[model samples]
Target: MKVTKDIGVWTGTWLLLWSTLAYIDFFGIGGISLDTYFFILSFIVVFITCYLIAKAFYRTPLQKTNIVNYKFIKILFVIVTCIYIPILYKSLVLMTNGNIWEYRAKAFGSNDEASILFGNQNLRILYTIFIEGGVYFIQFAFLSLYLLTGKKSYLFKGFVLIFVMSIVMLGRSPIYYYALLVIFTIIYRSNGKLSLKVPILASILACVLFFLSAYRAGGEITLSYFIDKYIVGYHLYGFSLFEKSGGANSFFATSSWFGQATLGSFSYLLLYPFSKILSINFLYFNSQEYLLKNSFIVLNNGDEANAFYTIFYDMYQDFSWGAPLIYGSIFGIVYGIVYKKAMLRKDLNSFMLMLFFLNVTFGMIFRNPLATNGFVGFFFYFLLYILFNKIMKKRLHV
Candidate 1:
């Protein structure tokens, strides 16, 4: 049986992922560009090299599941979903003012929620667990339960949770996750086999939810905002600025990126949502600061730069010309290890971790996502999965 996660990993890595660099940086303005060539060539080279290397390390992915524990996951995800629904409602209805997007733009974007967010340490932790913590895991959990257990209630509740969560939070990133969910749900329905109507209906419903989310965010929806803010918002225009303003060349002089790897530039940013809870000091490392300073997009438009600390940017900051190859090979080896392990265990939890890894890798193209609360939340859940597996093996002796 196919792992189902392969879809996200492949597309997230090679197919539709890294083109944003070229799309915004050079091609946005005019003629054939050298930077465009570099970005594309690097992407192709890295993708092929990584895939081939990972292929070498692959030892038959997880084929079929023998153990049955759908009941456990069903209760787990459903409980979390139920807990989250009310918190989400309270956060929206009582916490935020005015429209959803406006409140988000003010709280997260402007960072004005610090007082409310950081008022009490215990509440902060509780809020984190309630909001970004369990909620993130439940997204995957709901789908897994639905697919594995054949429960339409789980499916309906999962989709509704996703839709309402995105609407109340005013976030658009969940669109990708929903698409991935549809793919996985279809694939797993037949126990990793594919059919037409299941996937198709899943996709149609996802789109419906997406549009409903957009509508709920504000009564306004425009192609330009969607394309520009979400799509173009992730462009690599900062590279052009780096090229135009004479190469900084300072990266080669130091091993700063090594430090960044251990604690990424935005790792603190990842913990920001939990700052009130954890009492960790986090500095603002806005991606736009570099964009407005260098890239023509910000230079001309003068809009707040929503820069994507693009993969190349982080790699370049760490290793100038060798960024792609270095990072590419590293991720290839890591991906290979996970693929091999998932193949060996053939468990749903391990498979979900693989999916999470793929999502992080793909998002790395646009932002340093590995260090975010989203990724951190997944890490803890993966740990819990490992512990749960141990407990089950020890007690149930299955």
Candidate 2:
């Protein structure tokens, strides 16, 4: 079904509001304090850009389709397998570098490690890219094709394989798995509409489970914590007083809290550049010095390591206002294009596009948008899709 004018308006307005809030929360009103106003303007620019792009692509003529063939699929599979070998080998080699893992671990804990790792003038940024990038693009390729082709069995098998691999390689982050399931469910639901009753029940269950998990995790609770920490606490809440809270009260109180908030924030930020523009400086860059110093004190005071927050804090200190908006916008545009293109394919559905969008969004939020690993993965995936279609057409004599 074609996207209606109402849907377009709704999407644009939602994106604009969310983006503005997030950008403000992240970057704060710093020196010169143009952030808030700049963010508003940026939101308008982004919305118009995206709307125009969508309209153009949707209205453009679609390329003729080619018939599929087993031989073509096999050839494409072989090519993909070959390309993966080197990527896999390089990733493994980098994994052996203890410093990378140690820094990654430290970065996870709320330290300056992530900033140090990325900030080191001599550090090979490509290595960082290779280590964290490829998984999502791989996911996009498999899912997009399955959606386009309407091959449930193939999609199911691919999901299982990718899911298992992610768990094995990335460690235990339920958010990643849960995200995949959410996207798949959304996509599978006919016409992207979940029954209101089912969604309401699911939302209730999710809230209950979240509280149960938090309670089990154990922490002091307050009104600010509930609003800032729990309410807008997800990644999208942007920079607020809750983020200003220091010590154990900071949002990154624990790994689980950090994971949940980060995922939520990342999802919205990457999808909406205006949000990133507003929040990036304050949340990720400018706040680093404080985060590192505070986290260091907390460490001395018997707090568990908050290395990841520290790394984020350090990033703010290093890059200031420039890093978040510039990087975030570029990444958002790229991913938006991918999502738009994926949607154009007859085989894919909104569900698959949502999944791909989420993965891309997360990467852009936490890591540099231009990280090598993500770039290579995305490039290969898109290239493979184009090649696969070409080979299928040639074989079928279309």
Candidate 3:
């Protein structure tokens, strides 16, 4: 496949647009704060690393025989899905029994728990590990299968696995499924462009179906949530603009803008170690009091903080200046390897690249790795690689 100059331009443009959006989302529009600087620097590092990987894809020659077989990928996916079933079942049990949120709070060392009810230390630890580990492995299997098998059936199966795991572990959030749908459509589309009529009609159908699903799920599907929570709360107040009190909205509060700004910039470097240490200290030593007392801003809903600002702030609280450099370097190296390998194959496709991009955006940049299900990240990348090889072979006429 010949590398088009347009592809390069599109890649560069996407990076620029998303990075800017991310920066604004993280730091607001107050120019370069400590967080902003760290974020930009880390992003640049990751961007360069990914760019090299994409370049390698453009340069590498195609292969004749399959690198891996579809049967193997399918078996792997099945094994992973089976492994997740128990964990999912356990989470369902906990959620249904009304201990899900309580368990999360206690696991995180929240001082709100007056007494320890579940004294099965081993079981508790196992459950924690299972939930975390299961999600990561499930993601890996799903992504790997998608990459290895170009079959849309496998891709849909991957999405279903991810969706089930996410719902079980994280509760019902439509975002994951929506993201999967968008990615799948992008991957399956013959080209990026859609005829005006086709795209519009498809989009309308998607919206209608989304609402129908939500309605069937017993939740009132209102446009207000998207407008308020995701759009204004997340996109507007959460990024680029400040609230009247220089705080985040109810659904998305952060520490001081300065604190968040300082921490967010270097978050790529700070997030991992911070998560590791906090997880240990909170889980083992019962250190919730310190965090709560020292918190710059206490959110009414801590789960929101988990997805929004907790990771960045926690890192800053833990490792100050050293966080960004160490974390950024490690993340950059891993991303570099993935990108390099992908580029070398010359099989990188939009779907594969988009998955990588979203993983970095949602997992690495916006949320804490520890707080998230690592399997989702692993699954997305692996699936992309598998799908890239499968789909590119057909699309590129290799």
Per-candidate clash tally: 1, 31, 24
Candidate 2 lDDT score at position 364: 28
Candidate 1: tens digits of C-alpha lDDT, residues 218-326: 6666756655644554444344333333333343623334424423534554555786687764333444323333333343334334344444555555565566566
Residue 320 of model 3, lDDT score: 47
Model 1: runs farther than 4 Å from truth?
Answer: 1-40, 58-75, 94-102, 109-130, 144-155, 184-217, 223-255, 259-304, 340-345
For model 2, residues 175-206, the per-residue Cα lDDT tens digits are 34334344444344344544463456456535
Of candidates 3 and 1, the better by lDDT: 1
- What is the C-alpha local distance difference test score of each model? 0.53, 0.40, 0.42
**For every model shown, what is its TM-score relative to the native structure?**
0.70, 0.47, 0.53
Top of the candidates by lDDT? 1
Top-TM-score structure, candidate number = 1
lDDT of 2: 0.40
Question: On lDDT, who's better, 1 or 2?
Answer: 1
Error of 3 at 339 (Å): 2.1
* Best first by TM-score, ranked: 1, 3, 2
For candidate 3, write residues 290-356 as lDDT tens digits.
2342333322222132234323333343434444454444444544444444434423243344444
